[model samples]
Target chain A: MDGTLGEAGEFGLIAELVKIFEGSVDGDEHVLVGPGDDAAVLRIKHGHVVVSTDLMVEGRHFRRDWASASDVGHRAAAQNLSDINAMGGTARHLTIGLAAPADLPVEWALDFARGFAEECKSVGATVVGGDITRADEIVIAVTVIGQCTQSPVLRSGAEAGDVLALVGRQGWAAGGLAVLGRGFRSPRALVEAYRRPEPPYAAGRQAAEAGATSLIDVSDGLLAEARHLAEASGVAIDVRRGAFEIPEPLTAVGAALGADPMQFILGGGDDHALLATFPDVASVPTGWQVVGEVLEGSGVTVDGLAYDGPTGWTHF
Target chain B: MDGTLGEAGEFGLIAELVKIFEGSVDGDEHVLVGPGDDAAVLRIKHGHVVVSTDLMVEGRHFRRDWASASDVGHRAAAQNLSDINAMGGTARHLTIGLAAPADLPVEWALDFARGFAEECKSVGATVVGGDITRADEIVIAVTVIGQCTQSPVLRSGAEAGDVLALVGRQGWAAGGLAVLGRGFRSPRALVEAYRRPEPPYAAGRQAAEAGATSLIDVSDGLLAEARHLAEASGVAIDVRRGAFEIPEPLTAVGAALGADPMQFILGGGDDHALLATFPDVASVPTGWQVVGEVLEGSGVTVDGLAYDGPTGWTHF
Candidate 1:
């Protein structure tokens, strides 16, 4: 049981992974048939289901030395779950497809599952089933199934005169990544942000209830996400620099690195914050901060001017 | 569009991939929102939903030199779609997670998507959405969403009195793989089998409609899958060798390679065949061959004796 996955074999490793989620699966009323079947059967009371998938390759997404197995797992879950949240739906189930080198330790996988299970449990979700295979590098692909309690929100629904609001931290993860890149871990908050993002899970539904016109998750920096909303909705967005109250940690890290903290807020991503356009400021839910406004045009701007900063995360 | 993925960039490549599935998505009645959104919104008319995920890794599960991009794509979709079939559900939606080196040609990705789309179209399913990332090697993870018209058929429902049956070709892919492994490609059919498996997609629903006691897809050879069914159902299965009328192609390949054709029939896999247990031989659906029976015991046997040959494919 303590040996490498190569020794455990695929079936043996799957048994261990299944054992880790046994309690979660058994307790979930929605799951009619869990792991060990050809597929999982789940009762979906909602008429519509929101689905999304995210793939994280070992070195591209996280370095083992920089992030623990548990951190990687939580990060993967957070991103996928955030996609469901972006749709104004509650995350209900997850199916993971994992590929790792045969020499990987069995315990690493189990610990990863523990982290993933804890995250899902926190949001009233569970891992119903998954597949494991051998690969040269570690790759994790998670697909989240969610149910919409109301009409699903879309990025193209924004209209002119809508107020742009944000829920959850922005640029904290980017700041964290910057700090880690500079070889300084003392600013633990930033480093932790880079390790695992904490997306506002409930804010999505709250925004829907509050009559949000358009919605998206800020996996890319605020500017890039604002651009997405603007392009999709056929409207222009204008962000006011003074509207943001920069977090102290980001300020300190920016001072230390001789970089403007505003750049981090404007251009950094991986925070998984909810960005939505409401009919007006009053329609923005409590705990949501208004950072911009929608106008009758296209593209994103900062203080009526185009932002020349780096545009969030890009894979290629 | 004619350049490498690195040249196209993430958004550009995604635009291309989304274009490939545009027609499929537009024609689907179940799709509420398609790609370019944070997540796809799908209407699930069935009371319960069936979900499954599969991962394919380069070199391990496939090789670019051996299989074309389209072949790999078809293989990925086929395996995941078959999982839904095994649950006695109709596959309705798919979410793909693809990771490949940045320098890979964008045309390959487009070709892959085209193959995936064609396969899904054959069964009236569509690619709802997907994610693309950069990795050291190509890794594909596909998750399928399906709808069941009736109660799901689980692998644990087999009884001692049930008759075991199989639909779809078994061991044909295995024979193809063997032929390809030996640096010989004379038998075009066997090589084609390895390139892409043709699963009996309708037989799962047929078996379910005819009242199957238990059901499973033979991704692992028949013997391995039989063991899984037996162990899950707490019943033993007895396979009759004489029941299988070995195909002429397999027989010819076996003769040329000096291997027993029965070995492929019994131990070969990747055929995506549906194996089910029925209350009696009379309940077996058309096109399904009754090859064995469930017995009051544990494990599986061939001709009333333990099968000593290779059990089947092992991932790790």
Candidate 2:
């Protein structure tokens, strides 16, 4: 009667999981050979396949008490999907590797799969394959496969004199994280934002069509990612602090906590906003806002000065 | 001067680790974009891309005390590569997801990376990209991308009257595991085999070239994999127990341990040998040994009798 891994056993639990994931496939035949096989065969739909993977661990990536198992699934999916989006590609298929304690409830796994599958489907992709096993703690890794609509964008494509821009959500997740870290849970919107920041899923393709040269997701704050773009492209980027204009929910939270909203805008990551550079600001599409400009130098400068703040997040 | 991850830091260690992985790429341009990017772009060259991922936890999948860090890397790569081999495809690129303790020595990671990269190169592939981070316990997941030369050989392809043969080494690794588990390490060959079983890397293509109807690697023991093939193909497999011919070191070790070598031959999984079905016995390839026959039924029987022994292995 115990609906845990110990009761279902490895193969039995996998059987149940296989049925759950099978229901979520796109049915568009992007996956030639689905799960329950030695390996999955993916049909290459576009010019090329864009693949990326990210791993989440308990205590390090997520606190189980702070978020539900479903939220953990969402967080894992968001990380990988955002990477594909950063590449200017449409996600097509995904394979997940999940290892959890034997005592983990089967119902929890089912919910996690649903949330994970929901995220993939939202991006117009399918959860083609995955592996679920037993471990000491929860270890979830999702590898996303995407199809490039045109030339896949790279981080090294930015040019000197290009107008650096921003698209989609920003800063709210970091504010939400700060609130949650300080043990406050009343602000449901901010709490939810930290759990799963809505990424601009289709904006990567939009930017690609708009002829944007360089692009990256704000997984590592604006300043840090700007530095990455600049360093990778071998050019400098100068940000006009006046452009960020700390948006809604975050502003209220910042005021309540007596924290600088500018610091959040400058250093808050996990918003998954598309930070890109275009040859001309006029061609940078509708959703994007110009924030900085590329130059023939190195590193990043905020308003012509090195804005000394914490750069971003790291694993170590 | 502390050699731990806390002292080395994530980016600083990644900077060192990048050089280790970068040296393993296939020089002939299969990798369009290497590590340090959000995602890796691999040039597709075949019918389709074959992908499989496996997650190994510290105590469940391996023992740190038994296998060195380099051996852990080798074991991880071999498991993934053999999966592609099982599908009759040539491996091209790999993206790794690793989460280790913060106090883990930087030297340990470097050695692990070298072994991982070496195994990748051995299979004519490259480590395209990877993510490394901190976790309570080390978790390693490798997703291997392969290009199929022809219609992939699937587990469902075996038909009645097909000759089930095995190519490459077998039974040794499982026997090795048992001996190692028993806390005796004198039998160096068996101990080494358990640590890093050299899979028949080239025989997968050879079997495909010889027109294999069905194929699978003996990762979950021969009988267990035989059952997998039979169940997937909707047929029965009658394994001939008389044929395995108990090889030298295994027989000696079996005698020493008061164990039957046949059990290891029948159910040992980690050998990574290719167990496959062919249309004609004569066409089972030069290196292959015929040990079973496919028939019109379900499940697997050893010499016309149901196998009462342990089927294979599972973490749970």
- Candidate with maximal DockQ: 1
TM-score of candidate 2 on Cα atoms, chains taken together: 0.96
Give candidate 1's TM-score.
0.98
Sorted into a CAPRI-style docking class, model 1 comes out as: high
Model 2, span A16-76: residue lDDT tens: 7778678776485767788888888877844777889888888877888888878877878
Clashes of each: 1, 1
* DockQ values per model: 0.88, 0.72
Model 2 DockQ reads: 0.72
Question: Interface RMSD values for the candidates, listed in order?
Answer: 0.9, 1.3
Chain A TM-score of each candidate structure, as shown: 0.98, 0.96
For candidate 2, the docking band is medium
- How does residue B182 of candidate 2 score in lDDT? 87
Show where candidate 2 strays beyond 4 Å.
none
Q: In candidate 2, which residue pairs clash?
A: B221-B269
